[model samples]
Target: MENLTFEQLPQAMRLLHEKLDRLEQRFEEQNTLQDAETIFNVTQAAAFLHLSVATLYVKTSRREVPFNKQGKRLYFYKAELDEWVRKGRKKTMSEIREEAGQHVLSTKRRT
Candidate 1:
């Protein structure tokens, strides 16, 4: 890197301070708004989950996915949907093998 002269150092520092202040303002603006819970209908929920509405309907009828029934209307909570996706997470093959190894070792110790 080329060395900055004494005169250039103050100007560089001042420019950095201005950029930092702008970034701080943007962050503050983003966080100042209150976040409210969002509800999604079947169409929206299916779109959010990247599935077809028919599939979502089937899943909901089968009680496979998290949902709320209000009269005949179906509702989904955004947070609940996120949790549902998280709960369906599958472990990798290596992870399953490692867990099996641990179980085998524990069982042998008890024998």
Candidate 2:
């Protein structure tokens, strides 16, 4: 390694820091792509979601679950399945109360 002059040390450190940041960003992107691209068959999907195979099939049949169909095959993306579960999340009591308060305030202002 070359001895860095005092004046050049900060510039060198800045450049190294930028390179490390770029490397970290690329690593994160690759990991996200890997997770988002994960595909599961019906059996795997059922296991992943902790549901019975029969129940998974029922949801797919009724189009209640997010899925992909190609010919006679069904496919599920791990990301999509995660999102589906998140979408079904229920509000907490605090959240409902806050919403009710907002509604009451708005209604009072209307009159």
Candidate 3:
């Protein structure tokens, strides 16, 4: 780092403050975007989920996917869609084994 004279310190500090303010503003913008819930129509939802529109429609009709309906339109929240996908996740073999062990322990006689 270059040495700064007392006279240059204030100017350097001002520049540093401006850069910090910009960084903070960017961080806040990113947080605002994350805090906003994304709502997607059927087509957009289908694209997000990598499903064909017809297949998405079928799933919605079957009440298999999380969604909201307003009159003739369907709306899906991105967070809810993410959770719905997560709900279908298969347990790893170790997880299944742990669950089975717990079940066995719970059912065992106390004697």
Candidate 4:
């Protein structure tokens, strides 16, 4: 323990820092790849959407959900599922009426 001189300490610390940096870089790269992945199988998709497996299958049968098929296997993308959920949001009647009123105003202005 007492054999380590002052100059040796800095060199050892630098080596440790370089190794730590490489480890951190590898971790970040792995995390990025995981985050970028979007594919999910039927069970994963159902769990993500909080729907029953039967209901998910029904939607697939109706071609109402976004997915990819490889032979008999189906895959869903997390991003597409997110968008599908957003598209299913129902507009309030008041909001629809407001859009209709705007359409009428635009028509009058054109004429």
Candidate 5:
């Protein structure tokens, strides 16, 4: 302990502080990236959507939900799911069919 001079202590403290600052910056960057990444596992995706895992699987199978499969694992893109919900918010199959039928009738009258 007595071997080192007083000047060495300040340099050592400065080096330690620099290392700590770098570590803090790295941690913040990783946290930001994690917040940006929307990939979720099946359980996480189900929980996020407030749906059962089985129902999620069924919807995935029906192509109603977008998913990514990497080997045996499945992942959902949160953005795609959000967009899917937005697109489905205001219309049903019957409404769509009725609109198509009206279009057809209007076309026939014009002809």
Candidate 6:
């Protein structure tokens, strides 16, 4: 310790700081990757979508929602679920009424 000069001490400290920074960066990256790879449980998925667990189960049973089954546990992919919701989005009342009216008119004309 006493044999080391001031210049050597600074170099040693700099190297130590750089090593710690690299370690911290790697840890952060690893944590991010782990988070991305994590799959959500049914409750978590329901909460994420703001829906009830029963509704989630119904959707899963109807094959309207995306899920993954591992042994006894069920998991949902956040991205896939989000995309599915986006694709099968709810329609406005006006659109539904218009379609219903069109159907009724067509049926009446056929009769």
What are the clashing pairs of model 5? none
Give the alpha carbon lDDT tens digit for every residue of 9-80 in model 6: 998889889999999999999887776576799999999989999999998889888899889888997767
Question: Best by lDDT, which number?
Answer: 2
Looking at model 3, the pairs that clash are none
Candidate no. 2 TM-score: 0.78
**What lDDT would each prediction earn against the true structure?**
0.90, 0.97, 0.92, 0.91, 0.88, 0.88
Q: Model 5, residue 64: displacement in angstroms?
A: 1.1
lDDT of 4 by residue, 2-73 (tens): 587887999888988999999999999987667447699999999999999899999999999998999999
> Of models 1 and 2, which has the larger TM-score?
2
Return the candidate ranking by lDDT, descending. 2, 3, 4, 1, 6, 5
Where does model 5 exceed 4 Å of error? 1-36, 91-111
Give the CA lDDT, 0 to 100, for residue 2 in model 4. 50
Q: Assess the local accuracy of residue 26 in candidate 2 as a C-alpha lDDT between 0 and 100.
A: 100
User: Per-prediction TM-score, please?
Assistant: 0.67, 0.78, 0.65, 0.62, 0.50, 0.48
lDDT of each residue in 1-111, candidate 5, tens digit only: 346579798888898899999999999998766754778899999998899999999998898898999998889877777777788887789999999999999999999
Q: With candidate 3 superimposed using the best TM-score fit, by how many Å does residue 1's alpha carbon deviate from the native? A: 13
Query: Across residues 1-111, which tens digit of lDDT does each residue of candidate 2 receive?
Result: 899999999999999999999999999999889989999999999999999999999999999999999999999999999999999999999999999999999999999
Deviation from native of the Cα of residue 97 in model 3, angstroms: 1.2
Q: Which of candidates 1 and 5 reaches a greater lDDT? A: 1
Candidate 4: regions farther than 4 A off: 1-36
